[model samples]
Target: MQSELILKKDVDLHHSQDPYRVQNADEIDEDQSIERQLRFVLNRLTPENFQKLVINLINLPLNTQERLNTAVNIIYQNALNEELYSHLYAQACKLMSQIKVPFEHVSSKFISFLSILLKKCEKEFDTDYHKDKYYEYLVKEAEFVTDEQKRKQLLDQANEQLEKAKQNYIGNVSFLAELYNMDLLDDAILHEGIKRLFEKQEKDEENLECLCKLLTRVGPKFDNYKNKEKIDDYFEHLRDIYEKRFSISARIRFMILNLIELRENNWTPRHESGPKRIEEIRNQVLAEREERELRFAQTVPQTQIEFMVADGRRYSLFYGYAHHILDQLKYREDFDRVLGYILKVDPDRHSELFEALICISMDKSDQQRDLIGEFFYQNLKSKVFKLDQFKMGLRKVLLKALESYMKGYKFPKKLSQILANLIRLDFLDISFLKDAFEPVKRDQLCARIMAKTLKLAAEQIGCQNVSDIFELSGLDFNYFFENFENEVDRRDFFKEMRIEWVSTIHEHQRQSVELIQSFKEKLEVIFRETGEEPLAVLDRIEPEFHKEETKTKEFIRALSVVFFEKVLHHKRIDSDKFKKMENILVNFVKEHLDLQLEMLYSVQVLAFHMKYETNFLPVSFMLLYSDEIVERKAFFKWMNNPRGKGHGIAQVFLSSFFEHISRPQTEK
Candidate 1:
């Protein structure tokens, strides 16, 4: 029954679906015969099968003389049959030429080893110098064999021996080159191994060490690998270790240098494509911890010489790195380093550095953005920090600082003034604006200069405060630019300046005062019975909407005041009565429509009032444009009717429209 069961087991295993299934379960009972069967398996094996056999032979000892001779015979016969022997013999010749192997025992021990093995195996082939050389190698390997066990191990290691011989031939190159060759040979194997290594939760440290050595040697060359992801992971792992094991400065240096090189330069080495390579390098770099400590550790001390005698040594090694980055047109890093150095110096001594920072900040290069960000953090901190504190409650402090800077003797006047104005506008720090103004010595601040500074400030600091800058420079009210005693002359001058004011928003200062006066008078008329002051009216508006409302009121008051002021200077109308009448009209609009809309019922009343108060149509046109009425055709027909209260509205609306549409595009 036991025999039957065993036979059944053997049959089942023999017919099993496993690709590597053994012939029979009963065959396992004959252990010695199984060993013999394994020998047969080795002898008749194809290279693929031989590869599996080599895996099994990993560390088995091969020092026994009898087994070594047998192993030698088995391998020699197969090698001869496959012509691998000839390949080895040729490789040996190359090795012999590179290395001085003494030829004294040429035919004695060496020939005896090959002679015994070939004869025992009964294989014959033509001899050559290289063939004799291969014979000598086999003889030397046989020295490790003294018994059957050792000999068997040696025979099993024949493939390894052949690999070592080939390596010897290739090892004549530099160490780095040899390592590259090893990398090439194990390319597929290393890639898969590295992939698995990363995939496993617990990787072997020894394996990682081997991987690191290869990575450091290959460096960018790994970029050329088909499985670049593996290489990228290795770089990431290396950076991790660099942070973990190495100093922070070193890590930073590595990371920064790698990023600048890979991103700033269209670099290619082992990587096939430029963009892909840069992307891989960038991903690897950013994967590193960006803490300053890590950076400090990885950073190497750049060359610092007393004096630069050559292009290579002009800067400290770090400076050289800086130069390299700058040459790559990485303006940002260039700015950063320059600012850092500048900031390290005393504030009084930072002028040159500041100039450099300014210059870099002004450049329109791709790297300018990075440089500005870095420089802003490093050198601009002191100026910005103080300015921020001052700007918190008192905007004037910032404005004053910018003014002082602009007015200073050494400042770049045009740029500084423009910069200051931008700062005052809150597109920059008011303090920076003040600082800029003090430095100006230029005879004039042209629009182009102002525009550029505003642009830079807007880009760097943003434009949230740009519109609020009227207080800093006090508007271009230039009430003093011209003189007039005749009504016609005053009117002509007012018209010319109005043209100029419209062209230049900043020069509307005189008009600003007029707007304020007009707004006050209008408010007085609106609250005539209550007798509330202008300030009280202002106080009643929500703070959220106060700024825009105040600015608008000021603009209106200034325009009306300046126009009336000119007219009064020339006696164009009864000045006091004209002002009072204008105030009455403004107050009527404010009371009937502008402030009434706070309540829903009041909003309906405002809509009704806008229909009857046709004189307010021009102001409505200025403010609401097409939105003056809910519907255009209805408003138009109503305005055109001679009997309708909209008769005045029709004239004003048509005049405004034709003025808007017929005027040259530029004038508008």
Candidate 2:
């Protein structure tokens, strides 16, 4: 009775137009057997319902080989009928094999069924070949007999059968590839099938089409397998066929050439959408990012999403609304409302928000720049923003200013004004100037713009304070001086701006002199009170010179002068103390540039105190020369045009110093 039911359903499936269509209620109620249930589940398979279908199939009563055979037959027949769901069918077969119970041998069964199905398809291909020949003969005979209607009918039947045969062949090849992709079939089976098609293609163009279709479906996978040499040989054969087969249709020839190129590119199609194409795109993106980083040295790639979650809602404040508000900001009075809106939207990205505000204000009017400056000052003063955050924002702003300058924009006077305002507010200092300008030196235009901005800033804050800032910051004036090729432009610029470069130097010199005097007075007092060694006295008063580089150099020169005086007056020297002080001076000169002139001045001071006692000058000169404390070239250059020629002892000391250096060490 069960066999009869199965036979009845098979007949129904064979006759139905849409074999896998959902059965009606009357048809479904006729059978509740395991075979019927399997048929029902297989017909309804989908990606979303795949797991549920797997569970449903497992729950069916397939406790015997006979029932399992029936279920496998149903799955195979459904897959053959509906060719588009071949991958899903393959996946179902894999899942059933993993069950390890009654379905453990299900894979072997499916493979055997697939083998039989492939043979059946090949037999159909042969049958179609014979039918086409028969039709060709009938058409020719009818044409010879002048039967136009019969010839037309024969041609239509031939075309219809050929198309149907082509679709069935494509579907069969696709199913084989799908099973291979699911690892349910061996490479040997696939290789044999390809070999058979290649041989048949030598005679039949339809076979050639089938061969190309089969290869296109599974070529990349098969080439990547252990049979790469064999695949390569096959492609070589395909190339020869493509070149020599003149009777091949244009369409088939193009397919053959494309397949050859695809294999040559490691199975990566150039214009196709696949994993290899996606990977190539990803690599190109990374390379572009690296180039951008190299071009814009000051900018870093930011990957995090600029959004914040608040009250169960997402607000992309940095990218969307915050920038709009900041850009539209005009008057100072609107600062509070804008700030309120920004804080409400997202406060976590305040640094980025502030940076965006500074960048926007760069191209704005003077009034808007002033508004931003005032906005920053108020927030800074109210302690609503951290100093480090402000510094970070300003650093990024300087980079933006540089980018604008590179594009031939004029120097940003408004940005300079903002910086001056911050300096006056004591919220920013000169050290920030060094930090901001140091990284941009590789770009000369950006460096020059920075110098011009600082010059304009000096205009706002007054030259005296600017001079003091430069002196305290220890920023290299060469950054400013090198901007001009000749001295006249520098002098004219300074004169027109009432920025007395000479006076700034003199003022710093005068400050250094006063500072030296204070140190001398402190040393005298300490020595008088404790009768301590002069080195010990100096050590007690050694300030935190690390805070400033200029002061540190001045302190070292002061120590040199004081020690030389002590050595002259006492008619003796403390070797340990003198060596310690010399080490300090030598290390400082080594670490700094443009200090050779200063060391020369210190040597002159020692000479003046010594007067005609030239014996001690030789040791100091040799130490300076031998240790390379002062550069040797600068030392010789300075000796020829010695300073302080008004003093009689100056000429005498320099003459003797030259003789001492020119003489050999043994003679000394």
Q: Candidate 1 residues 569-621, lDDT tens each? A: 23233434443334322432343332212111122122223332333334333
Q: lDDT, candidate 2, residue 615?
A: 53
TM-score of each: 0.26, 0.33
Give the distance in Å from residue 606's predicted Cα in candidate 1 to where it truly belongs: 25
**lDDT for each of the candidates?**
0.37, 0.59
Which window of ten consecutive residues has the lowest lDDT sum in model 2? 642-651
Q: How would you encode candidate 2's per-residue C-alpha lDDT over 1-668 as one tens digit per residue?
A: 99989877835334666567776766753234667778788878864446445667866655454555566667765666677677787777665653322234553222333443445545544454545655566556656655678767777876776665566656666666777777767899788878887888867787777777667767767777589888878888888999898998999999888877777787677885423433245445644653454345334343543444433434344533434554445444478876676566434557677776676555445555555666776777676776567667677766765665523544445565465555441323345555555545455544445545556555444444454445444555556445565778767765754455533544434556777676556655654564445455545555523436434546556655665655443544444456545654554466454566566667665654443254555556656676667776566666544343112234344566665554545666
**Highest TM-score: which candidate?**
2
Give the poorly placed runs of model 2, Cα more than 4 Å off. 1-85, 96-158, 272-668
* lDDT value, residue 600 of candidate 1: 18
Model 2 TM-score is: 0.33
Q: Assess the local accuracy of residue 136 in candidate 2 as a C-alpha lDDT between 0 and 100.
A: 68
